[model samples]
Structures are given as C-alpha cells and as structure tokens.
Target: MEFTVKNVEETMAIAYKLGKFANSGDIICLNGDLGTGKTHFVKGLAKGLEIKEHITSPTFNIVNEYDGRIKLYHFDVYRVNDPDEIEAIGFDEYIFGEGVTVIEWSNYIKELIPKEHISVEIIKIPNKNLNYRKIILNYFGEKYNYIKEIFI
Candidate 1:
C-alpha cells in the first residue's frame, strides 16, 4: 500500500496504525534516505506498542531493545560494514524471537532478511513541501498480507 503524508505527524500516525496491530515475531524492514523520518516512524510505533521510554536510532550500538505490550527490537544497520556484522550480534535470535523487530536502512542487509517480512519505504517528494513524504508499504508473505488491509 502507498500513502502520502503532509508532515511528520501524519507520517508517524500511519506507522502508529501499523504498530497497533503488530504481533510477536513480526519483522518490519524500513528503507529510506537520511532525514526521511525513519526514526520518527519508529517512535510512533513504539508508542502504539505502549512503550513508555523514548525512542532513538541505534546507529552506534546497532540495536536498541524496548519493553512494551510486545517487546520491540529496533535495529539500525546504516553504519554496518558487512551483513556479518549483524550476524555477529546474534541477529537471528532477535528476528526469530518472541518480539517485533524493526530494521532501519534494511536494504543494507537485504540478503540477511527473511523472505516473509513487512517492508516500508519512505521517499521525499522533490519540489513538494519539504516535510512531505511518500510512504510505501509492502508485505512479503501470507502472514503479513493482513497488514495491507489496515491502510485500506
């Protein structure tokens, strides 16, 4: 599904809607350029998950764990030199574990991603309002198909 948002709040609101239906073992891959509000999207997701703590990109640490109705494993692989760098941190455990996982800059480690996952791509609309963003969401397997219905 595709959506256009006029500003940051609308962008986060869309993500928040998805997060409300998030289930354990769900993998959400986020692809966007710098300043595209990927982290803001995550912040709204965390709120929807009932997480009370602040959310921030784990650029240096690689991943940040949050406690919520369902645990959230937020990963930032933007600075990763190799996909193995993620494996070294026990990537499988988190993605396969009983929690929701969101990976920022996921395109960097696409080969390592599971075939069944949800993908969100945020694009800046050139010549449009500076805060405008085009968000596209795609699901990979039957398990995630229902998510598409939410945006509809």
Candidate 2:
C-alpha cells in the first residue's frame, strides 16, 4: 500500500501497525535513501514490540540488538561493500533466528535475503515541505498474506 506521510509521527504509526503483525523468523527489508526516516520507522517497531531502550541507526555498529516483547535484530548494511561481509557477521543467525529482523539498506545484500521476506520501500518526494514518503509492501510467502488485509 502507498502511504503519504505528512511527518515522522505518521511514519511511526505505520511502523506500529506493521509491528503488531511481526513474528519470529520474519525478515523485513527497508529500502530508501538517506534521511528518509528509516530509523524512525524502526523506533516505532521497537515500541510496538514493547522495547524500552533507545533505537538508533546501526551504521557503524552494523547491527543492534533489542530485547522487547520479542527479540529484534536491526541491521544497517549501507557501508557493507560485499555480501561476504554480511556472512562475516553471521547475519544468518539473526535473519533466521527466533525474532523479528529489520534491515536498512537491505538492497545492498538483496541476494542474501530469504525469498519469503517482507519488503518495505520508502521514497521521498522533492519540493514538498512535508516529509512525504511512498511506502510499498510486498509479501513473498503465505505467512505474510494476511498483512495485506491490515495495511492494503
């Protein structure tokens, strides 16, 4: 579904809705340009999971773990130059682990992602005072088909 976010609050609301349906073993691929509020959406996800800690972009750290109602593995692959770099960090353990995983700049390691992952794409519109964004949702497996009912 397409979302016209007027500000960060709206974006977080969308993330909160999505978070309610997030489950273990779920992989979310976030695609967008820099300063597109990717991290803001992630903060909403953490809140939905009942996480109390602060959530930030995992740029230099690469990954950040949060303990919430369920485990959350946040990844930022913008600086990663090779797919092998993902493996070096043992991303599989988290991608396939017992928690929800959200990957920023996931397009960088597209080949490493599972086929059944959920894809969320955000686009910024130029010349708009409001932080306009187009959010696209694509489900790759039967497990996520129900998500369409909620957002689409």
Candidate 3:
C-alpha cells in the first residue's frame, strides 16, 4: 500500500502502528535516501515495542539491540561493503531469533533479506516541501498482511 505524510510526525505515527504488529522473527526492510527519516521511523518502532532505550542510527555499529515488549534488532547496512560482512556479524542469528528486526539501507543487503519480509520504501517528493515523504509498504506474506489495517 502507499501512504503520504506531510511531516516527520506522521511518518513516525505510521511506523509506530506497523511496529505494534511486530512479532518474533519479523523482518522489516527499509529503503530510502539520506535524510529520509528512516531512523526516526525506527525510533517510533522502538516506542511501539515499549522500548525505553534511546534510538540512534546504527550506521557505524551495523546493529543495535534494544530490550522492549520484544527484543528489537535494528540494523543499518549502509556501510556494509558486502553480504559476507553481515554473515561475519551473525546476521542470521538476529533475523531467525526472537526479535523484530528492521534493516535500514536494506538495498545494500538485498540478497540477505528473507523472502517473507515487509518492505517499506520512502521517497521525498521533489520541490514539494522538505518534510514531505511518500511511503510505500509491501508485504510478502499473510503474517504481515494485516499491515493494511494498521499502516494507515
């Protein structure tokens, strides 16, 4: 489904709603350019998970784990040079484990992402406004098909 938000707050609101459906072993793939607010959405996701830790983009660290209603594994794969880098960091352990994983700049790690993942693509509307964002959500399986109900 497609959605448009006028500002950052709306982006977070949508993300928070989607995050509520997060379950163990859920994979959320985020694709967007710099300053698109992927990290903000992630913070909102953590908020929905009832996590108390401060959220930050894990660009340098690759992954950030948080304690919440369920474990939240947030990954920023932009700096990753290769898929092997993910394997070196034990990527499978997080995705297949008990946590909801969100990967930013996931296009870099495309081959590593699961087939049954939820894809969120954010695009900035040119010349519209600095904060305007168009978000597209696509689900791969019935498990996350409920996204339509909450993604609005």
Q: Counting only residues 3 or more apart in sequence or on different chains, how many pairs clash (N, Cα, C under 3 Å) in candidate 3?
A: 0
Per-model CA lDDT versus the true structure: 0.93, 0.89, 0.90
On residues 1-152, what C-alpha lDDT tens digit does candidate 2 reach at each position? 67888788888999988887788888999999998889999998888888899999999999999998889999999999999999998999999999999999999999999999889888888765666877777889998987888786
Clashing pairs in 1: none
| Candidate no. 1 TM-score | 0.97
Error of 1 at 69 (Å): 0.6
Better of 1 and 2 by TM-score: 1
lDDT of 2 at 37: 88
Listed per candidate, the RMSD to the true structure in angstroms reads 1.0, 1.1, 1.2
Model 2, position 49, has a per-residue lDDT of: 85
Candidate 3 residue-wise lDDT, 3-92, digit = tens: 898888999988888777788888999999999889998988888898999999998999999999999999999989989999998999
> What local lDDT score does residue 60 receive in model 1, on the 0 to 100 scale?
95
Candidate 1, residues 1-152: lDDT per residue as tens digits? Answer: 88998889998898888889999999999999999999999998998898999999999999999999999999999999999999999999999999999999999999999999999999999865367889999998888877967877
What TM-score would each prediction reach against the true structure? Answer: 0.97, 0.96, 0.95
